[model samples]
Target: MEILERNVEKILAVLSLLAISLIFVYIFKNSDASIINWDEEKVNLNINDKVYENLYIDKINVPPVKAGDVVTITKKDFKLSDNNENLVFRTYGSTIDVFLSGENIYSYGEDLYREGKTLGRGYHIVKLRSLGDKTSDLVIKQRIVEDMSYRWVDFFKFTSSNNIWHEILINNVFGIVSGIFLFSLGAFGNLVYVVLFLITKKNNLHLSYSFATMFFIGLWNCTTSGIIQAITGNYEIISFLEYFSIYATFVMYLFLVALIKKKSGKTKAIDIVKLLSLLILIGATALHLSGTLCISKTIMLFRNYALIVLLVLFYTLYIDYKNQKKYENVLLIGNCISFALIVVHIIIHNFNLTEIMDITNDNLITIAVLVMIIIPLFLYFLELDEIEKYEMQIRVLKSLAYIDKLTGLGNRTSGIAYIMDLIKNGFDYYIVMFDLNNLKEVNDHLGHDKGDEMLVNFANCLNSSFSDDYCKKIRYGGDEFIVVAQFDKVEDINDNIKQLFRVIDEVNRDGEKGYSLSVSYGIASSKEFATTGYENVVKLADERMYSYKSEVKNQICET
Candidate 1:
């Protein structure tokens, strides 16, 4: 009862200390106020001075552990703050067994290995349970199953009640947080884009795919950080996710590239590259899950394959740039950045240079994945803006094709199409053809500008005479205008012509211009000429208009 009460108090104290330490980690990670005693002299696993070397040091040439090597590291009579405190360390691609005084104290990953599975990286927090009073040798035998980027197991200091994840997170919080940010951004962004596409019929699915790729990138980042084991004890599941997300993210990235380049009509290059890389990724995944060959062993191949994809796409982007395609330069810069990082990773891994290594090479990889997802988004927005602008220009050109500039009405082509449409629909309609009385005289006597003004005033009169619901006013040519209207009866057609004459009278009554706007028009109804075509009706209207012109001339002579 007394020991349990003491242990609980110690645990509370350690938790409070870790809480404050986490604040420092977020605010300033290099603060001296640390919860875990990182100093080798006070927090080491060994009571003797021999165990103090390379404890939590960032760069050391500790020998690389190979598969099937059962290396034993023993600590005799290791000092512990209390019986409740636990020993913690990190190992990659290995199984571990701990024996205290020749009795098995803790064992991990053996069952997974027996099942022909790769025991993923583990943050082992071995509990110190033993004869409370006896001092014994703590023997740790680690069997390496695969060679990794960081091959040596690092023994981190002890913490109360298996609370050792804070130390690993403290030094590497930026990459981890960046990973979570990417994951969150991708998840929310994908949901919004997908919903937008489904509901509003907006096609931003390529951006959604890009977001999905970011989601997998974040998953890969979090899974390999070795902090997930502390959060959830499912190392096997996390390990699988770590590798599976790699393949998924890579494939999604390739798919996004193909989607972008597909519109360029030169997709053969990207298609071939994607196909070959896809085949390899699929094969690698099958073998990895089936326990034939682990996916960790195939990362080298895939990364090198990624270089090929980038190289081929580089040529594709160059061609697009030459052709002045939008967003190509942005994507080119992104590809170059990623290509350079991949080169750095390859160089570091090939030479095994610990001098430049920041604990693990995976952090650099997370940045590369971030680059692939984020850079595409910038280009997507640029492309989207350019596409909308192009569409607007097309609409303007189409409008100009059917409109007359001087009269602000439909042109001759529009009148012909409108007349033919009314005839085709079998609608009871009226087609009125009007010719200005003295347009040529106005042009020859008062200059062409006055003639243009008269033409515009008459178009305004036509517009005011009929509502757009069933009327189309067209400036067919100089001094020749057409008005097409649908009406229930010919009486309604006469009423509109009366309105047209009234509007012309109003315009002349204004006395703004020196000349009066006069028009002679002849109307033909579709119902009256069901057998005669629209062209014949228009010809009859033209003949009547000439007769009206003669009547106007005769009345002028009498006046």
Candidate 2:
């Protein structure tokens, strides 16, 4: 029945995830606005013999190009029916000047020959004035400011101003939403861990590293998806964030190493590799900030390095798993999936074969990384739950070991240990030793079970008379019991004993077991027996108890 319930819960969880994913896909698909693909559209371009032209721009092949080279595109037959509709031109990898009937309408980026001006790197959207029934040719003159092995435009899309923004949002909707989800997951994980650390006053490095990794990966997705560019329109900030995200990965790897060390113990080699990765990240950041190296140019190399480091980290975790380290299996599974996705992405990117891979507009790799982060975190939480349950079980077992089964009081071993602990701690306590009178006689006349009832009755009397905060009551042995209590004055102990006797008298009057219960007890104090030690005090209490028992026997004989 328990196994069936668990399976049902698993099925429900899978259904919930599928439902959310379907909803996400549906929303993204519907948000797309109308867009014109230049390659597919019937647009005529007049490119002079100096520049190459292709009927299908998507399949264009071209020669090498350097800075200051100009290429003109003239769409002569294009006409707009709506005069109020604004023209939006989008492209990448070069500075562009748009002209309508030989008049320059908009310009982007610095002059082609400018030395220090930053060149545009990613998608750019320029809005033009209303066409207004003008049959004039639409012309675009693009200057290649960055060196390119192939002189080809990556994207050229034509749309209205409103649709242009909408298209950008639509194109990046999955990334934007997923990035926010990842960020929120990371932030919430961090918040939970921070609260736990504050309450428990202990550090959890594994969760810390996991959250940091997720946060930076989410930030990276946001930047790469063009969402930040759409919102801020700051190329420099976007560019810097790209590098920052990469560096953040390096730091995140270091944290992962720290977590591994905490779980499975450290190795000098792993430590050295972590340090080297940190130095490389720092050096790259420094060079980029100083303009000594272009981050865009070096990003692929850094990614390659990061992939190598990730593989190494995964291998180390595998080794730890082989060594039977706890929770390593979950980490290994998550890391392996992430590693495979990274490998696929690298291959597709380097070969420019995203189309062949059918992953041109997909965020599968991003989702895989999200899974990579989430699975381990989920497993960690499960482990925590198990630990808590195990600890609770241990507490229960320990209590059982120390408690008496018949009377529900501390057993002999625990009672002795308690007194020894008090003596070692130098706490002053009054000790009371008790022995039930005529217990053997009751056991022989009635039964052992009835005698056990008497023992329980006496235990109930002790519990009713003494406060747990100040008193330790134990069923020391057969018919023998002991109590150790702390009191502000010696008279307080006497008063408590008088109260105990009254409780005993009340229980005797009830006569539920058809027999009267009686006890002979002796009291001693830690202060009075300081020179003799607590063990001797216990012996003295035992001797006085026997003496009291004998005196009661003589009174019984006389009666």
Candidate 3:
């Protein structure tokens, strides 16, 4: 049972790799799939039960045709109305033996003259034979013309054989090879790691492996279409398959954008840019499908441009390495190498310089090389020393900027910047201002250390009670804290603060020293001072806080 199951798994894996390889091979083979038009005039028609027709062009450039031959011809749009049967002119290679309706009619030299001429226009399939005892090679071609009678058709001509099909086939083969490698080495490992990571509840590691799998899958598919064209000399199939590969890449690109956006939180501007790029991709695809455009040239450009973007993103990784170093360094290196392989393939394919000697789709195998070799090794080399330096630099800068290290809250400088940004954007938000009571008396009775502890405790309580989504917390000064909530309405701001304060009171009652911490609070809505801006809101909230504090103090004094 185990052996059978293993065999089935192997079969499935091979099939998947084959599928991806075919897709990429198809794309690469049909990079230049546009039709090439050749000019031609009247081809001599020989109706042979036994008849010979000789067709010749003297001065004009025509696709080559000789006497005594059978040819298949096609035009853009022309139909023969004789029984609605499109004409196919046929003749023997050597003998001028012609048969109409399976009955022998005539031979060229014995029964008819070879110099007989018949001219009919639009597109014609003409057969001819030289007036000799020996036979020559058979040639066939398709032609198009405006008017056949006037157009000059020259004598036999030849053209260099097209190698586009050959190149396409080889590319498709390469695609297959690369796909197999990616599936076996990169994606297999990634899949295993993803499943294991998720089972172990390592969400970050799971994310890394999941992304790795997708990236390699895309890589595998993009190259296989090229390999297909390399093997079988079929251009039409290659062109059709290329469309699939491009569509696959479009999907992968979207997935990449979504992954990055998910990590970076909400950024509307970046989302908008990605949306525009997606629209362009869709437009290009639609054009190709409708046969109005062939986007292979554009796709080729995008492959290289995508590499440059990937390189830039790699630098961004280096820039952010410090902050992201705690988990899955291995996955980062894997991603980098996978992207590098794609870049290398583009360089090799575009420049005709990959193998230096023998060229094949196996070059795509380099992605597996990176995943199985480079990434694992890079992970081992990861050190915290550089990251530590970055964090230390950030710490020093934050101290000088607007971080209050004692309570871990934003200080005056950063607080002002945050509020000013909201005001510049012309948003409606609420400002809540508050101050701790009885600090001086507590400091005198229990020393400055106890007073400092009380202040830190109060900051911690506010931090825990308030969420950053709706409110931005700030240490306004000693014994004072402020929160600016950005939103559309004042009631939401008021209700949220009331709920947060109730939670804080509960937390205080749970116990802390002999005395419970208390504060007087006030709120100012953005609507109340739309013309006055953020500074006015701050001033108004502070004034309300002072008034509330005085009233509470008066109540205490009366008691």
Alpha-carbon local distance difference test for all models: 0.70, 0.67, 0.50
Q: Candidate 3 on 408-473: residue-level lDDT in tens?
A: 888878888888888788777788898888778789898888788877877787777677676788
Tens-digit lDDT track of model 2 for 351-443:
555254323433655665666656555555555557667878997998898999889999988888888888788788888899988789989
Instruction: Report the candidate with higher lDDT, 2 versus 3.
Output: 2
- Model 3 lowest lDDT segment of ten: 143-152
Q: RMSD, each candidate, Å?
A: 12.1, 6.9, 16.7
Tens-place lDDT digits, model 1, residues 1-559: 3334334333432432343235335634453235544433122222222344324333443465457766666665665555336777766677888887788888888998887786766577777764567776767777778765544554444556344566666545655665565576668667766665565665655766777887888777777765566578886667677777777887888888888877778778888877876787678768777766654476656677767877887788777876646556778778888888877877776566767765445656765666777666666656655765787898798679879999999998888888788778767677788999888888988899999999988888888887767889888787899888887777887898899888888888977687898889888776666584777778877888888889999999999
Ranking by TM-score: 2, 1, 3
Badly placed stretches (over 4 Å) of model 1 are: 1-71, 82-84, 96-107, 127-134, 141-157, 160-167, 195-210, 226-233, 255-268, 310-334, 373-396, 410-451, 458-559
Candidate 2 has its poorest 10 consecutive residues by lDDT at 36-45
TM-score of each: 0.67, 0.68, 0.39
Residue-pair clashes per candidate: 0, 0, 41
The best candidate by lDDT is 1
Q: What order do candidates take by lDDT, descending?
A: 1, 2, 3
TM-score-best of 1 and 2? 2
Sequence-dependent TM-score of model 3: 0.39
